[model samples]
Target: MNSINRILIAGSFLLLAACSPKIYGTVQLVDANLQPIQAAQDSPQGSIVNMINTTGSIGQSSHAVTVDVEGKFESEKEKVTPGMYKVEASRIGYATETETVEIKKFTGKKIEFKLKKILEGKRATIKGAASDEDKIINPGEVSIQPPSM
Candidate 1:
């Protein structure tokens, strides 16, 4: 009976630990000049530090961290899995940044993102694709809108 009780307790501990999340890194938010910028610690949803999945999966937003006034952020220690993720940061008047990073299971690791200044009417197209390419993705019939009377 003593052995059985001990085994049960050990199993419970393992189960709880497995359910906990894993933290990727000690992320820090920076600006274009490579200077640390303090993120709003007002609310979790309004935080400047957010992790995005590069694969465009809408369901991968479970892990989020509220950056402190020192611009340092951290995710749940045991709720996140080790994998490739995009550490995104956005601030008013600053260009949004999405940095591709590989999150590891190791602790005390840190990731830094540098945000740029937003340019007016800046082209956001990815490189290597010609502007006048004949190939059309999701092509649809062109509609001519008559001038409103």
Candidate 2:
């Protein structure tokens, strides 16, 4: 009976480790000031990152991992297959960034992404509103203060 139980346990361990690639990596979210976000992995204000498996083989599905407080994320051992994946990062006030990351031979990789903030107070300035043929002179907005003239 003891021998049978030991054999069964060994077989189970082998079956569990037979196949499925294991890939790993770290993710980080930084503002325009190049500062690390405190709650980068939290919701509402924290950035959301997902890895979509675009290989399209058969039964493969996309995988989503939560980044740590220090902006680090790792994929599950068997969930991540060896192929091309689309990494997308999104935040509330920051721009959404999408990038392609490949996992070759189940090797670990490091990916870094920088987010650009949207300016709300800055005025939008349109340059070259006039066509080339209809060149208008003195279109610049210049404020001149004259005391006497």
Candidate 3:
């Protein structure tokens, strides 16, 4: 093909690529009860640090930048795109939860995650009983014991 034809072909290809739509979404952080939490305040690296340090969990993903002013999460709404994403939530002193979010062109979806605090408690309990059907043991007896402190 001539140079003009080649240039025309390349331009057409570029035009088609530019016309293609894009897909996007955001990751939000919430309490175990799913209530919106405030964004982290100033940090050397930014709010993500405060969020990671105070709450321990990062936003599900790095794409969703931290919006401390807004209790809720937000992201740029882009052109139509389709795909599945594994959203994640993390915290230092809390249990992390992840979920899948689907995005489609010309539409928006929300993927909210609720994280729970990492329990740090000492507690225990034990209880049981025996019936006539349990009497056939070599020594049918039920016993309970606590720490020998």
The clash number for model 3 is 9
Predicted candidate 1 versus true structure: per-residue lDDT over 22-127, tens digit per residue = 4333334445576655556222223466666454346664456765645566666554555666676666656666667665544333566555544457669676
Q: For model 2, where is the 10-residue window of minimal lDDT?
A: 37-46
RMSD of 1: 12.2
Per-residue lDDT, model 3, residue 89, is 51
Task: Write model 3 residue lDDT over 86-137, tens digit each, in one string.
Answer: 5445545545666655654444555444555444788777655567786455
lDDT winner between 1 and 2, please give it: 2
TM per model? Answer: 0.45, 0.53, 0.38
What C-alpha RMSD separates each model from the true structure? Answer: 12.2, 11.7, 12.8
Which of the predicted structures, 1 or 2, would earn the higher TM-score when compared with the native? Answer: 2
Best by lDDT: 2
Model 2 steric clash pairs: none
In candidate 2 the C-alpha lDDT for residue 95 amounts to 76
lDDT score for residue 142 of model 1: 62
| Candidate 2 local lDDT, residue 121 | 79
